[model samples]
Target: MRKDRKNTHLKCCIMEISGRITKDAVTAKVSNDREVVNFSIAINDSYRPKGAEELKKIVTYIDCSYWMGSKMAQWLKKGTVVELFGRIGLNVYNNAEGKALGSLTFHTSNIKILVFPKTENSSSLPAVQKKNTDQDTPDDLPF
Candidate 1:
């Protein structure tokens, strides 16, 4: 039996996710033969209370998929930090062990390279060793 997901807000118009890419972008054509890109990302969230002992933080990993042109698929990579806004999607699949598995994927309408947030955290930006390396993906989510 599969656990029912109470939070079925996959249709949320926009969301801000800041985390490390878990896998390289997988590009494929949708059933309609339309180009689509898919990838997984993990977001880290912890808790810290004042005048308290050690606390554990909740970490969330959301699978992201970009159903767009081929240009977007060619621009995904592991460990790349990105901030995106799009709708959420879910899919069921069978693993090598033949067990039914489910995944939460994000269908982005637009994405951008995170530069700087109100808080100063340079680590969120992509670390490109080469000065002129291109890091923009073909993400076109709704603004």
Candidate 2:
């Protein structure tokens, strides 16, 4: 029998990023009769250069596409913080002006909402009790 040269130790690459949504998600139908949700996210970072006295903030924008159900688009609104896990993709194309353009894309396999931006009507909600300690609990136990 011939020897098999397949390498079983090869590793796959995975990327995870957390950022705020730049805008609401949009849904579109693909050629395969499937719906996809498209959105953008902005990741911000601050760092001080080698000899700089002050720190500078850098923002990286990434376009993301989700192939799951379109219902998720409704919850992904602007300013919502989300955590995404997926692979990175680079897309190159020509714009309407015939100029070459390139963009970084994140093909997200999984996404989670980290924080929902507070709305003006949120204040109308009732406040929750902080403590439920035994000292404050009623002695009427069914046990």
Candidate 3:
């Protein structure tokens, strides 16, 4: 978290999280006809306690909103693994039964798609493309 000069409150709370999209992203229009992309991601983690024979698995879901552009919603499909950089926030509210509940939210500034979900027709898994090293370099060099 980045604080202001006075340190009264946080100016920016930038954080990076990598997770899989829980569902397809949704775009909604707000005041003044502005649009926002909303989505949720599930982060999976596991830990082994001391003197434990098994690992305990945990899953945390965080709601994310992107105000930069709504066009990116098309590519933020379900099961897409992505790395998000943004401000992290927590919303604490009281439930009807007087229980305190807290929810995590991320105001996304940038997104990087890590992996796309497999399609029915595809037999092999998708992978990031690497540069071909077999190609010869041109002799016309400025260096």
Best-fitting candidate, scored by TM-score: 3
- Return model 1's CA RMSD, one decimal: 11.3
Give the range where candidate 2 is weakest over 10 consecutive residues by summed lDDT.
1-10
Off by over 4 Å in 3: 1-12, 121-143
lDDT of 2 by residue, 1-143 (tens): 12322222223487889999998889998867799999999999999999999999999999999997787888888888999998888766666666666778888889998987676865433343677698977899888
Order of models, best lDDT first: 3, 2, 1
lDDT of each: 0.68, 0.81, 0.84
Structural similarity to truth (TM-score) of each candidate? 0.59, 0.72, 0.76
lDDT of 3 by residue, 18-50 (tens): 999999899999977799999999999999999
Per-residue CA lDDT of model 1 for 1-143, tens digit only, reads: 44433334455557766676776678877677787787777788878788879887887898877765667654466666778888776777666666767777777777775532222664444454666534564466577
lDDT assessment of candidate 1:
0.68
